[model samples]
Target chain A: MVRVTELTNLAVDLVDVHKTYRKTVQALRGVNVQVRRGEIFGLLGPNGAGKSTLVKIMMTVVRPDKLVGTILGRPLGNRKKLALIGYLPENHRFPPYLTGEELLDYYGALAKVPKAMRRRRAAELLEWVAMSKWAKTCVGEYSKGMMQRLGLVQALLNDPQLLVLDEPTDGLDPAGRRAVRELLLRLRSEGKTIFLNSHLLSELEMVCDRVSILVNGLVARQGTLRELTEHTVEYRITTTGDLAAVKEAVERCGARIDNTVIILNGHNVAKVNELIDLLRGKGVLIESVVPHRFSLEEVFMETLGTAR
Target chain B: MQFCALIVDSLRHALDRKLFWILVAITVLVTLMMLSIGFEGGKVSLFFGLVEAEVDSYDPLAASGKARLVGVVIYGLMDFFLGWVGITLVIIATAGLFPAMMESGVIDVVLSKPISRPVLFLYKYLASMVFVLIQAVLFVGFTFLVMGLRWGVWVPGYLLCIPLLVLLFSYVYCVSVLVAVLTRSTLAVILISLGAWVVFSGVRQAPAIFDTFPELQKHHVTHQVVRAVSWIPPKTADVTYLAAKWSNAGTSLDIIPASAMEDVSAAERGQLERSNQWEKEQLEISAFSSIGSSLLFEVFVVLLAMWKFTRMDF
Candidate 1:
């Protein structure tokens, strides 16, 4: 197990964390990863890939058999440090008797926030989540989307240093998802580190500055979005006029020709330039040059499939 | 402050469940029934579907070993409600506390907070006790007031039932908590608690029943086994008897006649004598030995639960 002392910029730096459930299933196996400060870090994994378990260990909701590292500059499982963290567990269920405002207050109180501030934060978050009108409505009466919004509000009650969200937009409409993306961006700009575990590849791709893909209890890849997608870069060149000339020019330069279109593969920047120069030299009117990179979903599927 | 919030959270959870209100309503209704029984001069008037016709009533002021039959009957019913019916309601109401809290999503959010697991577990335990405590206070407090206003005697000892009822319920609640932690099933908790209570009560009657049939040597062995079983589950009956004894109410229930033991063997007779003395002393001594022994068992069970809880992954 790797143990690092407090590093200020590291919001969550966990190393060699392992957990074996009931002495039978090893949910997490020597997983090591770090989430940088002031960045939205998305953790992508398939189901039963130990995403929630890893987060639970960081939150101290679950104890790992072998865990070493720090969260928010404190040792893993530090109780007081939790007050600085805002967590939204997956599929959370709130007390039915409590209204939206009351539920916020309850979570706020658990963080040991004082009376006036709890109410103030509750009001602020309710409005921020567009739940101000339903503040007094019972949680049980609220729809799933409403509850997800309220869950987001409850997570922000403490104004935490690190916001750990598991499937934060699990039950949201398209507009709600867009709103959450905006909200997360706003929170990010406020200098809060977000550790997000989400199955929505597109959502994560849009919001996450960096991402770690976990495959079968291991960190398969972890880096900035640029780093993960850089290798999958490809280029598509379109030309007009003579297709025979375009194909002849593109084929000579080792590019695939499909009708009037020439497909350039890989991060071979020089090859791309060679093809562009060759097309122009052939006097074929160039139409379009499109650089294509793998989407987060494609990367995820490829990573998972390769791991299997 | 967080601890208080956790307790409030638990209270809020209980408030959400229908059982809590049902138990509260029962306590209130029972308290009202206690208030309806009246004794004036030498006549007793009972309301609540009981005897409405005037009957002879005993005076507490008299210098005799006699209690107003109406007062005794009311007190008996009071004990019965708070002891048996109230306990059942409490067990059912709070049985789901642990299981509900320990549910996957629920436990994660709560336990991930800045609180220790043991302290959190203990707060939950105290929270369950609060349900019984509030109901007991209301039930005992209202009945005490009625006993004073109607019977014209203020037995502060009656107020002892509040704590006694809490202690009695704690005994069962402790078992319910242990079972809940182990099974995480509200129905399982309730069923096991009810089963344990029934077994304890059945075991308690062993000595009395053995004294009734001392002629059978097998009765002696059966009585011994039952008495041993009594030491396992918390002596809830012993707590009830202790409350009655403290309030200067019905003493030990002596069923078999002394002459009935004469035909038995000397050893069997000796066992009968010792058992009788133990029961009498059990009530008079505040049922301390039985309750103490039983409380130890509850503590052990709770410790087992806490140990398992702290060791659990989630």
Candidate 2:
């Protein structure tokens, strides 16, 4: 029953994953991550933060030195379970000689997708990615954005339950990125799990239901957007009147003054109320008071700084 | 299905290269050259009768002349051209397959598939042999048709060159894959595999070289070591002789025109006899030992390479 629940609830549950390259460079160290089923889960990290390495371990492209978890309800590296997973690696290379259709058919076949189904999926996916017109064109002639789009199509050829994409928007223009973003959301709506590893925090923030920020081979933070940013709330007060009159009073209230705005850190409603009362009593004309949440980039940078 | 996909993909890759067409063109030219030579009654005609030579004792209709023709096809075309030059060209064309497959962006997607790394490695190794297989089929198949239809001299055994050439190539290609998997460098694969081929041939011929010197042959210890070491590498030099022997092309000396040897001095004739004896001795090696031992070596190298591939971080 526990196994059944895990199988239904989590698409990926990795624990104590460790990987050291050439006996020295520790790409991952005691990293634990859990991705719920049917959600777009973003894995954010700076370069060398082991985000790609962790994804590689999950996809069985790179072996982990130590790991204890289940992927799609089976032990990690399960070949049969791999059939249910689709992976679009960063900077994926398709055979230059093969046309777009052939590349899909070839990788689909490797994933053990049957011929008829591969053909059908290839057609549907090419249309979905707006690549049907270029189906017959050789991959060598494709632009980088086209290659990235084709890579996404190839990953979905098997109609995998779990989609792991590393840098899916690496070379895409804004329009292409938006299309991919929408496609990712559509896949999630259809109950497919997406484990995205990328440096594009804004992209992930728009689509991901939850995210894990990896730093120096560890998960610095892992939670939903609200859960991660809830603690980082701040209230900014904009006033038409000069705040030099009540600057000392605002500082005494643990709020800092920056230009005409008073910045109050934390989610303390009473402290914000007290600051507002003091500003009003001083006859300062309050323009607006807004509670602001930290963006994913700020969270990522903070996590990175904390990890460092 | 995955294995079939790999093979088909390999075929497509081979077709993508200019070398494949160049090889096909070479085969066509060789076939045309073979077509230009005509056998008439008791004489030989070269280049559509542009040159003719009288054979007073050699009759094209005789059994001996037919055997000579078969010998020339086996030893000259199959053994020398396909076995040496064709194999080298195919090697250069295919030595990059594994390394290319292992390229950073390429390997990640491939290795993430449902297939096991060892199986993928082995399938890829076999797929590379498809290049040699296609070349051998074309070269031998075309020559066989030309010999049967044009010359009316059919030796069905000559068809064995197809598989024989593939086997010969496998002996060297196994080393090429091992190097490619280890280094993932195309240049390293090409250079080391070609170097290994030369070393394989040299080692296989060491025992024969020892027999030429009475002093070395008399040392039982050194002779035993040389003989034992010679059995270790794939017997690449023995493949041509095996093809000639298996195809029943007769001895290498049987292909010599009797008219041409008439004016040779006694000393030269003796040297020719000695060389013929050496060729005969090479042919006398048992087919089982030659092929079996060579296959064993190939299996070892392939398994070693597969182990490296399976255990690799890629």
The fnat scores of all predictions, in order, read: 0.80, 0.80
Model 2 chain B weakest lDDT span, ten residues long: B250-259
**Candidate 1: C-alpha lDDT:** 0.80
Question: By TM-score, who's the top model here?
Answer: 2
Instruction: Give me candidate 2's interface root-mean-square deviation.
Output: 0.8
For each candidate, the DockQ is 0.75, 0.83
**Whole-model Cα lDDT of every candidate shown, in order:** 0.80, 0.88
Q: How well is candidate 2 docked (DockQ)?
A: 0.83
Q: Tens digit of lDDT per residue, candidate 1, span B180-239?
A: 888899999999998888877777665666555557447666677866775676776777
| Tens-digit per-residue lDDT, A1-308, candidate 2 | 43674546889989999999999999999999999999999998899999888988888788999998899888877788899998999978889999999999899999999999999999998998889999999999999999999999989999999999999999999998999998899899999999998888889899999999998999999999999998898999999968888999999999999999999999999999999899999999999999999999999898888889
* TM-score (C-alpha, index-matched) for candidate 1: 0.89
> Which portions of model 1 miss their true places by more than 4 Å?
A1-4, A241-254, A280-283, B48-71, B207-212, B215-229, B251-279
